[model samples]
Target: MLHPCVVVSGVLLSLAVPTIISMESCEFSGMPGMPGIPGLPGRDGRDGEKGEKGQPGRLWQDKPQKGDQGEPGVMGPSGKRGVVGKPGPKGARGHQGLPGEPGEASHTDATQQSAFSVARGTATMPGRSSLIRFTNVITDFNKDYNTETGHFRCRVQGTYYFVYHASAEEKLCVVLKLENTIVASFCDHVQNHNSRQVSSGGLSVYVRRDQEVWLETGDYRGMTGKPEGYSIFSGFLINAH
Candidate 1:
């Protein structure tokens, strides 16, 4: 160890008081302090991985629109025919109708009552209405003709057919009448002055019930003779309305 006070060769040496070296003895030990500035931000992190698949959601309400129409279906087969039903009961008879009016002429018989007369001789007066008695009543249906008066009083309303025959000596003229109306006339002259000539006639007239028909030969002169049934008057009802 070297003493501080020791000197050699006439020189003085001294020592400082601090025992060891400190930072204060270095170059910048007494400088003032200052805050540090912030640095730039770091880069953003990468995207995360995908999550698990979710469950199907439930329906909340009905759909608003109508569905589209389907195509038309095929036609069905026809059904079999059914059996016939039973017959119905008979109906009740209806009431009788009103009585009908009289029928037509076809309803009457073709062969009906007829009238006839035959005469002998009856001279008639001229300018006066006269009746020649048809002396023989051959057929007088309904007893309507009068042989004594030479008149046929009709008993039924109908169309009637009439006929007459007369024979005379010399010359004889006669007129036929219905009631007061003259209908026909006949004239006959003598043949060979003795054999006698004949005349005849026929007519269809409408005769009402109670009307009269007769033959008159008294006009101008009178009828002379009669040849049995040749001189006759006859009538019949042809039809009735």
Candidate 2:
């Protein structure tokens, strides 16, 4: 009930108790005054209530110093094609290589010699597919046989090997053409017309460049030539193409 600053601090404590008892009987103690002008900065406090989540810090074991090379990471979308890897164990046979620069001289079986044989000295009877003239040359290496065009021309261009032999006495049917296309044939039905039958034949074709080959005679011409029996026609050149 006595509040006006507590009744003015009880009347200044009874007037400062007789002026501190007359300054404690007056003596001397004075000189200490001039220091007071610094007081206006204090009003900012209100923020304190959110503090409970702090126990997770121990993971720094020291391996992190390789930095400075990073500017290349924008090319990553092409990576899904990788399942074909099983063919790698057969590679050790290589060291024999440096001897190559010397070519361009081929074709030599004596320059791809096309051969021939020919025969038929006189006993002709060729009509009914004609062409059997073969005069007689036993072995004409490059003449390519043409005893007045009985044909064997193929100036060398493939597998030849033709052959023939006749010596008949009555019925023979030799054939062996190539451009006219009969390939090969030979027959002899000489039931002993005094005995003379030799007929033979052969094949292996594929001639090309000029291509002729002959020896006809289908409706039996009975070809027996020379003195009494020899009628050949051979050919050669078994590989060139």
lDDT of 1: 0.68
lDDT of 1 by residue, 1-241 (tens): 7665565422522232242243456555466768678889989999999999999899879778888999999989998999999999999999999999997767555334556555544443223346666666677777777866768888778888988766555566677798889888776665576565566778899988789988776444435443342466778888774
lDDT of each: 0.68, 0.83
Per-residue C-alpha lDDT of model 2 across residues 1-241, encoded as one tens digit per residue:
7789989998999999999999998877889999999999999999999999999999999998998897887776887888998888888798888888988987656757778888888886677667788787888887778898788888879998888878888898888888888876777789988878788878788889887888888888888685868888888987888
Q: What TM-score does prediction 1 earn? A: 0.47
In TM-score terms, which candidate is top?
1
lDDT of 2: 0.83
Native-to-model Cα distance after best TM-score fit, residue 82 in candidate 1, in Å: 53
Candidate 2: segments with Cα more than 4 A from true spot: 1-74, 77-114, 124-135, 142-160, 163-172, 175-202, 205-221, 224-232
Predicted model with the maximum lDDT:
2
Candidate 1 regions exceeding 4 Å error are 1-112, 121-129, 218-230
- Steric clash pairs (candidate 2): none
Residue 82 of model 2 has an lDDT of 85
Q: What is the C-alpha RMSD of each candidate to the true structure, in Å?
A: 21.4, 18.2
